[model samples]
Target: MKRVDVAYVLLFDEQHEKVLMVKNKGANSSYYTLPGGAVEAGETLEEAAIREVKEETGVDIEIGGLSTVSEAFFEERGHHALFFTFTGKIVGGKIEILFPDEIEEIKWMEIDEAETYMYIPEKLNGYVKTNISIPYILRGNVIDKG
Candidate 1:
């Protein structure tokens, strides 16, 4: 299978009470997820995280720590996706829909309220509590890595 690299950021307010998220405006979707996307060539994971957030939300952020690294196989996409997630804080820039065609909406929702609309819930679960996290590398529900 082919391989892909993706980087995401978990940005919260100064009080850590709210998170930045974006809603999809696609023809067949009603889910909101963190602001992030693919890592382009020659850009570091941190750089990609910063760029994706800006493109999606028009917000500049200061990346903190590497919160998680995960890998998943997608039968539909025919590829193994490697994900790098980091913690960040909004340091500058105003929140705006830079890409209206791609995003239905963007907002700062309370951390607790985000549970209802976040598309990839696993990506955010227990996220802020740790500096590093990795999902089980498993096959057939059996742990495949230590």
Candidate 2:
């Protein structure tokens, strides 16, 4: 399987009450996930996170430390994807669907509520709720059974 690198930024509001998420278009249209995308060649994870968030949600963010690292295998596509999720804060820009073709919607939802919509990483809710003093590393074969 070919390895793919992806970067995701988890951004919470000032009160840290709600998290920023985007409803993707196409196949997983109903699922809501963090504002992020694939890391292009020569771009750092932090840079990819910032660029993806701006392109998908029209929100600019400054990434903090690494939050979690996850791996998912797409059985059908023969892809091994590495997900690097980082803690981030909104630095500027407004909440809007910059690429309506790729992003269905953008919203800030409570952590608990958002977890229900984010089904990929089963332990994501706990990670986000905890005090991220140390980086969380999760290792498993997350097969894309869907």
lDDT string, candidate 1, 7-73, tens digits: 8777776677787889868567756878888888887676788899999999998676665677889
Count of clashes, each model: 0, 0
Q: Which stretches of candidate 1 lie over 4 Å from their true place?
A: 115-146
What's the TM-score of each model vs. the native? 0.76, 0.83
lDDT of 2 by residue, 1-146 (tens): 98989998878877888888898876744667888999999887767888998998887777776766788899888989998878877778888887777888888898888767545366555667763733433343221111
TM-score of 2: 0.83
Question: Using TM-score as the measure, which candidate wins?
Answer: 2
Pairs that clash in candidate 1 = none
Which TM-score value belongs to model 1?
Answer: 0.76
Candidate 2, position 131, lDDT: 30
